[model samples]
Target: MQFVCPQCHISYPATSQRLRCAECGGPLDVADRKRFDPAAINTEDHSLWRYRAMLSLPDGARVVSMGEGMTPLVEAGFAGQPIHFKLEYISPSGSFKDRGTTVLTTALKAWGVTRAADDSSGNAGASFAAYCARAGLAAEVFTPASASPAKLAQIAVFGARLNKVEGAREKATEALEAAAGGGLVYASHAWSPLTLEGTKTIAYEIWEQLGRGVPTCYVCPIGQGSLLLGAYRGFKDLLAAGLIAKLPRIIGVQSIACMPIVEALRQGLDRAAPVEKKLSVAEGISLARPIRDREILRAIRESGGDALAVSDDETLAAQRDLAQIGLYVEPTSAVVGAALKRLKVDGVTVAALTGSGLKSPPALR
Candidate 1:
């Protein structure tokens, strides 16, 4: 497998430390042309690494894992329609980001890279710090000052240098970008191809848990489009492997306060345009400008899907409603539930509950 520019199609060695295409400055993808076989599935290992055959790790590479994946897919009723919920908040760091963190950190270890820096709202920072600690790699996580206190505490507890950037999440990302040029490896979950490779396991697990059948729709909250891109790639892989007939309609949820992808889709734009973001309780998905905006918009359009935005009030109501049903999730994850209130699907419909309520904003608590 090699890193291939999604635009220019230029290939780079898998071990290359570069994040984007040098030739076109476009996003790079781990271009693994190898076809996956269902018969090669590791039945004994239930973790995300069980899909090792399809992952893009080098031979004899040491894995940095935390038994992530195999999250529960529970059936429930939402908006008077039968829907499913993938409980991703139960992971090691209380978010789905762990799946990517494990693979990205492990890949960094294999490349002999030690110090790493990343920018995140909250969940990604904590997840990265935890995995870096497990991998014996030094980490510095930059997060917005408005991030949840619990998340900041979690990052610090994991022994990572926590730098709180004032203003919006973009400020933190900019701070990390500048620091990364000064010898620190940028382990951006949004920019790293390896991170998406790890998140693709979510699609595989969902397929297996549903008796190898694809759902009618997959609803996910989009911040930097990490999970959205991962789901798209995973379902595409399944289609390529002849394991599924078609990709499920992927609905991307976002905060109305900051809905770049939603606006782009609604306006029929090929790329996302910057928006004026406001303070939102769903801080996890409050990205004014997503770096992979084009890729995310493309994935939604190709899957015959659409994007939705909900108010903070609706997200809070959905979070409480989910809690009433014994599924307590953070308000950011609750945006999917908020979106579900408007969706009327027939067949199986699944939405990812990405973060635990413990990491939610103080108002929700």
Candidate 2:
């Protein structure tokens, strides 16, 4: 099993230490691997590693994890429609990226990497720092200078070096890449395929929660597109292995301030054109340039799914709705809840609350 570049057709072995496609310089992933066997489901354990057989990891690899999986699938409603909230903020670092970092960090450690560098809006860096700490790997994170101070502090608290860049969210990637030397592995959540491998567990858990049935639709907020792509790749594996009969239509929500993927879909382009970066309250999903842009758009398109945008006001209001129902989530996660009113479909839906709202900026609350 291996990861193939969407742009270059260059295939890298699943265990390749190199992250980007050697052929076209595009991002890569462990997407094309086989699916799970219901017969092999390890109901005994709870973390994302429960789906170990479904991933491309080596046998008996020491997984660097922080108990990031089995997040609650909360039942909620809006306009009398049934909705399920996949609360991911309950993760160790208070976001879904913990799932990815857990697996990616372990993989880096297995590759003999003692130091790594990457970038994020907030959660990814924190999660990576935590796992890297556990794995005894040095981590350096570059983030937008405008991120939540608390979130930035968490990175340092984890003993990871932090680089605060002056500019937009997109520039964070440039800075991190620039700083990454031959000795430092770029364990970038946006570029690393293994990171999303851990995220695929969300799909498996959703299936288990629904009595082994797929949700009618999954509305998620996309930043680097890890969650969306993970779910998409997970379902694809399941279908290939005859684990599930079909896949859900993936609906992604983006902030109006910087909805690059939405514009890409609307324009029928696989690649998301560049857009001016804006400081949105939902820092986690505020990417103007995603590394997996083409693959992400392909998932949105192939699933017969659509990309939608919601205003900052609407997202904040949904944060209150989540709190009322007893889920403290950040604005990025709340965007999925806010997107429910905007969805045209009428059926059982799952909106992944990407983060816990307690992390929202004080002014918004």
Candidate 3:
């Protein structure tokens, strides 16, 4: 498989070690979907690796996994309509980001990477740290100072070198990028196609759980949009394989405090302009400028999806409601819960509960 720029249509080999497009500086995506083999899926494995045939890792590569995937698909209700929920927070790292971290770290192991760096508000860093620890590689995770204490604690507990950036969330990313200059492979969940390789398995699992059928809508919260893009890519592969008749409409939910993607979609722009981000309880989805903004917007538009933003109050209320149902999720994950109320759902809908509520503030819990 090769990485291709969606905008420039330029291609590069998978082993090129380049993060972005060398020509146009755009985000790179894995366009070679010929490897996806639904018939060859490893049915015995209950984790994301069950779909290993579709990943970009080299043959016989060591997979760094913690059984992350195969989350439960349970029936639930939202706004007086029945819907399905992907309980992704039950992952090893307590968040859906583990799905991507496993694949990315496995690829790193294949490439003989000794050290890696990444930036996250919380969950991605913790997931990366845990996988890198399992892979016996050194990890340096940069996180914002305002990151949840639970997530920061998880990162440190995984024995990663934690660098806390004092300013905005973007500062952590900047710090990680600068550290990557020191020969550390940037195993970024947001920027790496390898990460998407893991996350896309969620779609495959959802397809199987639905009896190889496509849902009417797929909803989730967006920060850097890794999961959203992964879902889009996976469903695209399923459609190509004739396993599904159509793709689900991708609905992205963002906090009103940081709605760059929503604003970009609303304005019909190819890329998201920077927004003055406000402090939000749903800190996980408070990214100001997503690196994959164009790709994210394209996926939503292509799938006939729309983006929406909700207030902190709405997200908090969603969290409380979910807790009452015994499904404790972080406020960021609750963004999807809030969104389900506003969307006009005509058929089966599925929303991803991205992170566990244990990652939230103690007071909120």
Candidate 4:
């Protein structure tokens, strides 16, 4: 397997720590074109590792896992419509990020990396910190100073050095990049292809749980678009294996406060457009510039998907509605619920509840 840039087709060794292509500065993807096979799945392992045959890792690498994956696909009611909510929050790190962190950490250990750095608004940082601790690697996380106290506490408790950078979310990423220059492995969820390798397992689980069929539509909150892109790739794998006829319509939700993807889609742009960043209750998806902007747009367009933005008030209302249904998720996850109300999508649809409400401020919860 090699790290290949989708934009410029530049290839790097699979074990290379470089996050993006030097030629084009685009995010890299694993160039392993291995197809998915249901018979090859390790039925005994319930975690994402069950799809070990499909993952792109060094041969014989030890999987650093905390039993993350196979989140319950619960069919619930939202706005008088029955929808399947993929509860990704019931994870080792209280968010969907554990899926990527597990695989990324395993890859880092395989590559002989002992120290790693990453940045996130909250969930991804906490998740990476926890996984690094499990792998006995020195971990440092850079997060926005305005990040939730609960999430910062989680990162600190895992024994990882936490750097709270003041200002915008991108400032935290800048801090992480500076540390990476000082010899720390950049285990970024947005830039690392291995992270997608882990997140694609979600599509496999959804297929397995849904009687080996694809859903009509899949909705999820998008920041860096890892979850959506990963699911799209997984479904593509299933399609290659002849297990499914077509990919599901993937709907990406963003906050109206910071909706670059939505604006780009509306304008038929090939990349995410620069927009005025505003403070949002859903801090997690408030990314002003996603690294994989072009790839995300392609995924949405190719799958006949759409991107939509919801207001903060609508997101909070959705949060309350989800809580009423016993699904307590962070405001970021609630964006999907708000999008669903707007789409009023019928038939078999899955909404990814990405993070736990416990990770948010107590007042929000």
Instruction: State which candidate has the highest TM-score.
Output: 4
**Tens-digit per-residue lDDT, 1-365, candidate 2:** 46778666777776625678887788875655655777777788788778777767754568777677999988876645778888888888888888888878777777778888888878888888888889898889999898888788889999999999998777888887777777876777777778778888888889888888788798899888899998998777677777677778999999999899999998989799988867677778887778888888989888889988888899888888777878787888888878887676556688887776655555643
lDDT, each prediction: 0.89, 0.81, 0.87, 0.90
Please tell me which model should have the higher lDDT, number 3 or number 4: 4
Worst 10 residues of 1 by lDDT: 32-41
Q: Order the candidates by lDDT, highest first — what do you get? A: 4, 1, 3, 2
Better of 2 and 3 by TM-score: 3
What TM-score would each prediction reach against the true structure? 0.96, 0.94, 0.96, 0.97
Worst 10 residues of 4 by lDDT: 356-365
By summed lDDT, which 10 consecutive residues of candidate 2 come out lowest? 356-365
Error of 2 at 195 (Å): 1.3
Report lDDT (Cα) of residue 287, candidate 1.
Answer: 82
lDDT of 2 at 337: 75
How far does residue 44 in candidate 2 sit from its true spot (Å)?
A: 0.9
- Model 3, 1-365: lDDT tens digits are 57888778998877626789999887788776555677889999988888877777755688888888999999977678788999999999999999988888888888778988899999999998999899999999999998998999999999999999999988998887777755688877787878778888888999999998879999999998989988998899888887787889999999999999999988889999999999998899898888888888999999999999999999989888877777899999999889987877988899999999998854943
Question: Model 2 misses residue 350 by how many Å?
Answer: 0.9
lDDT of 4 by residue, 121-191 (tens): 98999999999999999999999999999999999999999999999898888877777856688888888
Instruction: Please rank every candidate by TM-score, starting with the best.
Output: 4, 1, 3, 2
On residues 234-275, what C-alpha lDDT tens digit does candidate 1 reach at each position? 899899988899999999999999999989988999888999
The numbered model that scores best in lDDT is: 4
